[model samples]
Target: MTGTMQLAAEGASDHRGLIIGLFGAFVVATLAITVWAGRQNKDADDYYAGGRSFTGFQNGLAISGDYMSAASFLGIAGAIALYGYDGFLYSIGFLVAWLVALLLVAEPLRNSGRFTMADVLAYRMRQRPVRTAAGTSTIVVSIFYLLAQMVGAGTLVALLLGIDGEAGRRWVVVGVGIVMVLYVTVGGMKGTTWVQMIKAVLLIAGTLLITVLVLNKFGWNISALLGAAAESSGKGTAYLEPGLKYGISDLSKLDFISLAVALVLGTAGLPHILVRFYTVPTAKAARKSVNWAIGIIGAFYLMTIALGFGAAALVGPDRIIASNAAGNTAAPLLAEAVGGGPGSTGGAILLAVISAVAFATILAVVAGLTLASSASFAHDLWANVIRKGKASEKEEVLTAKIAAIAIGAVSIVLGIFADKLNTAALVALAFAVAASANLPTILYSLFWKRFTTSGALWSIYGGLASSVLLVVFSPVLSGSETALFPDSDFAFFPLSNPGLVSIPLGFLLGWLGTVVSKEKADPAKFAEMEVRSLTGAGAH
Candidate 1:
């Protein structure tokens, strides 16, 4: 037993060297891509919307890269390994949400907007107030999304280096934040989009490699895989069923419902995701991109089922839990196991390759989130509100770069504080906030002729305020062992997610604010917006 333990330690040391080397290589390659793309930017369009140059397939792939975040990879895999069927449901919600983006938001938003979502929201409303609200909500939602990627980075680096406790994770998070700010400030949108397209391809290829290995190990028999996973999960048949994670009690069930709502409705409102639509040249390209994104993203999520169960079957649930306590390392551990376990060269190579892909994914995502938020601040708030549309393109781009630095610093701080939470759950809270604050205002602005400037302001501010406030008092923040503040008990809200209540309230506030206000929206402007949205008559 002593000899075997010594051998395992030696193997882990070997794997660590290989993993770090691969990580460095991937980062260098992506930075090269960023620098190469950055040299082409000549104006605000190039920096903010990739100069509307990407094809449907390219933009589609980038969207897939941005959407298949660390939450989709690390968080979802960990959830499934621990909770079985319930965990896989997160994939279903995410995939369904894309349809909402495709059918309702894609063409219209592309036709109506420019660099950011505010361009559309402010089309007919009071520009300064609506832009302020949209800018604020965009930054807030992007920050929430940024936290997930940063936390995932910390967890990934910690697991590979065998670093324990908060200090290791904190340093990793800060490093990730710095790297992301560099990606945004140097590359801008064109550079970032190219990196995302490359990252998406790498992620899908890595996932396919692991999925195939897992299937082959099970003799290509899914039933065999399921049986082994169920047995190894230490829950027998319950591991393959629904109640293991979420359906146990009324509160858990309600939490599940809220989670589903957020995941399903949140994609359309995501600032980074929404901004991707503006990167294409035509509304047709936007629609085509959504189709491509759906196909690519759908296939990736299906592969995650294999990843999640493979981890359970090969790595064992207790070992996965022991690794990070959040299951963020399950996919990487499973890669090691499938390639012949810890002591072998095959295991080291696979682990290094998989982990490298994960690092690249996190980097690319953080770049996208930062770019979106900074664009909102510079284009919507700084240029339009602060400078009253008089800021030069050079000045606007400079402000965006500075905003990226500030946002990166803020995300690094929050990432340290929220490092204990699961990446997928952290993203779910972000989704809830986006759904509550951004979606109702977007939908109303596009569809309702009576939507006044006050209605938009009320909806955006009210929804944003309510969801964020609920999260602070909810179990996600305190009162439970898994909460961010585990030592305290200030949780007053019962549900872990606030989507179920906050989303409806957002829509309600928009309606009520419209009805009570005496100010009339510009009918001529609404007619023009409708024509432009539906028929692409005057799209930029």
Candidate 2:
């Protein structure tokens, strides 16, 4: 027994070295890209939109990388591994959300927007107030999303390096924060896009590799794999059905629906994802990017089911739950198990590579979020709001870099504080806010002729405030052992997610404010925006 324990310890040390080495390689590669991007970035256009240089295929891959954050790759797979079929519903909702982006948002937004989402939103409205509202929503959504990625980063590092305690996790979070800030500050959008594109390819390749290996283990029979997963989940065949993670009660059902609503609408409104549209040259390119993104993202999510089930079948729920109750380590453990166990060189290498990929996913996502938030700050607030649109392109880009640092600092603090929270829940709240706040205002502005500045402000504020307040009082924050605040139950709101209530309230507020306001409709501005959005006439 003593000899066996010594050998296990040695194996763990070997794995750590491999994981750190791979992570270093990824960092060096991405930083090189950032350096090159910095040299090429000549103006605000390059800093914000990569000079609109990326092709549809390139932008599409970058978009997929931005959208497929650690939450989507690790959290979703972990959820499916832990809860079985119920977790797969999230994959469906996320994939379906791209349809919302492709059909309703991509072309019009690319045609109308320049740097930030506020550009498109403020075009036909009161510039200062509209931009301010959009900026606020962008910051809120991005920060929330950033927090999740950062926390996931910390947890991921701790898992990969076999670190213990809050101190190690905090350091990991800070390191991730600094790296993300550097990526945004140095590379801006151009550098960040290339980093994401690279990470996307690596992420897809890693997922595909593990999936194929898992299938090979089961003789390439998916049915056999599912059967084994169900058997090993301890719940037997019941694991193959829904309602394990949700649908236990009326409120649970409502929470599930709310989660679905958020995932379906939120992807269209996420600032980081929407900004990808502006990275391409034209509306046609933007539309093509969305189509390509749909294919890539859809295929990735489908593969996640196999990864998740393979983890369940091979690694078992007992091991996964022991490692992390949230199952965040399922994929890594699955890699270890499928590659010949943690004792072997193959297992150590595969786990390390996947770990590196997960870290890259977090880094790319956080960089995009930071860029989106900083762009909103520099473009909408600093340039237009504070300077009255007189700020030079150089000053705007500089302000963006500063804003990235500030946002990264705030995210570090928030990430450390929220490290124990579930990654999927944190991401869901971000989506709820995006769906409820950003989407309503954007849809009204783009499609509704009667949408007023008053309506836009109302929608943004109403939805933002509601989502925040509800989440604060929701069960996810308290009321249960898994809650972020598990010691006390201050959950006045029964639902875990607020999208069901807040989303409708957002749209309602938009229409009601427009109808009730004494402000007259600006028909000429609307007509101009409509023509520009539809035909790309006079669009920059």
Candidate 3:
């Protein structure tokens, strides 16, 4: 028994080394590219959008890279491994959100805006308040997203390298931060775009390979594989049957709804995703990019179903619980089991590749988020609003770089503080805030003539306030005894998710504010906004 336990520990350690080495190699390569690109960043436009030269296909690939974060890679697979069919709800919500982007939000946003979403809203409204609010929202959402990514990176590195906790996480954060600063400051959009495209391809290819292998191991039988997973999961027929487990008050049900709301609405409103649209040369290209993104994202989500079930059945829950503690490590462990033991050549190679891909995914996404947040602060608010649009291109780019570093540091601090929280849940909170605070103002500004500046202001403030308060009182936040409300661990609301409640309130507040301020609203300015956003009249 002692020898067997020792062998298991040794096997896990060897697997960790293999994965860490592969991940390290990818980080070095990304850093080199970022540095090379940074040397060529000549102006603000270059730093912001790679001089707006990307084609639809390239931009589409980059979008996929940005969209697939730690949540898509680690969280989804882990959830599926533990919870069975409930995990697929995340895939469905994510895929559906792209439709909202494609059919409603994509082209108009591209046609109306230049660098930031604030630019779109401020095109007609008072630029000061609009830029300030937008910048604040961008920073808030990006920081939230960044913290989640940093925490995941740290946890993953520690798990993969067998390093001590803080050491592993700090190294991962610093490595990722430097690579991102290099990508945005030097290569600008061009470098970021290429990196994203490469990462997306790697992620998709790796997932497909794993899915195919898993299915083959199950005798190419989907139903039988699911049946086995359902039985093993202890969730009974509810595991296979959709909505049959409705109204259960278990942790599984709570987690399922929270995940669904965050994945769906969050994708549509993310600052990094909105910024990607600016890289495309035309509004039509922006539309095309979104369509391609939908198809790619859809395929990836479909593959996740197989990967999750494969982990649940073949790896077994007991081993997963003992090894991962959080159950998120099930996918990689399952990969090793499928290929053979960790010391086997095939198992080691696949494990190495998956870890490398995960590392690259986090790096690409954090870079994009940092760039967007930096641009919002330096370009939209500081350069344009505070400097009265007087700063030189060099000064503006310098400011953005400085902002990126500062934001990166802040994210590291937050990541350390929130280490115990789940990455998926934190990311969902960020999405809820984005959907609540930013999306409503953006949609109304472009489409509603009655949208007064006062309405926009109130909407931004109201949404931001409500979402933050809800998150603060959420089960995830308040459930901990050491958290902000140590005396009261139970949330005021049973549900941790706020999107189901706060998103609608944002829209309603915007409309009400607009209606109340109708007399003060500019009619001619509203018409011009409609033309610019809807007809491609001013697009360059």
Per-model lDDT: 0.91, 0.89, 0.77
User: For candidate 2, lDDT tens digit of each residue in 1-540?
Assistant: 123223323445676766778999999999998999989999999999999999999999999999999888888888899889998888899899999999999999998888888998888899999999999899999999998898789877777676777898899999999999999999999999999999999999999999999999999999999999999999888798878878677777888999999999999999999989998988999999999999999999999989899999998888777776777778887887888886788877787888889999999999999999999999999999999989999999999999999999999998887766667778889999999999998888999898999999999999999999999998878898777778989899999889999999999999998999999878889999999999889878
| lDDT per residue as tens, model 3, 1-540 | 123223333545656666666776776776677667667667777788777788888899999999888778776777677767666676688789898788778888888888898988888788888788889989999998997788667766555555554665577667666666767666666677778888899899888888988899889999988988887877777777655333365754665665566667777688999999999888888998998998899899999898888887787666665544445566666666677655676665666577677778888888888889998999888888899889898888889878888888788777766655556666778888888888899889887877778888888888888888888777767765424344567677556668867788888999888888754667898888788888789875
Error of 3 at 484 (Å): 9.8
Q: Candidate 2, which segments miss by more than 4 Å at Cα?
A: 1-10
Model 1 lDDT vs. the true structure? 0.91
Clashing pairs in model 2?
none
Error of 3 at 170 (Å): 4.2
Clashing pairs in 3: 37-186, 37-187, 38-186, 38-187
Clashes of each: 0, 0, 4
What RMSD does each model have against the real structure?
A: 2.0, 2.1, 3.0
Candidate 1 residue spans exceeding 4 A from truth: 1-10
TM-score of 3: 0.92
Per-prediction TM-score = 0.98, 0.97, 0.92
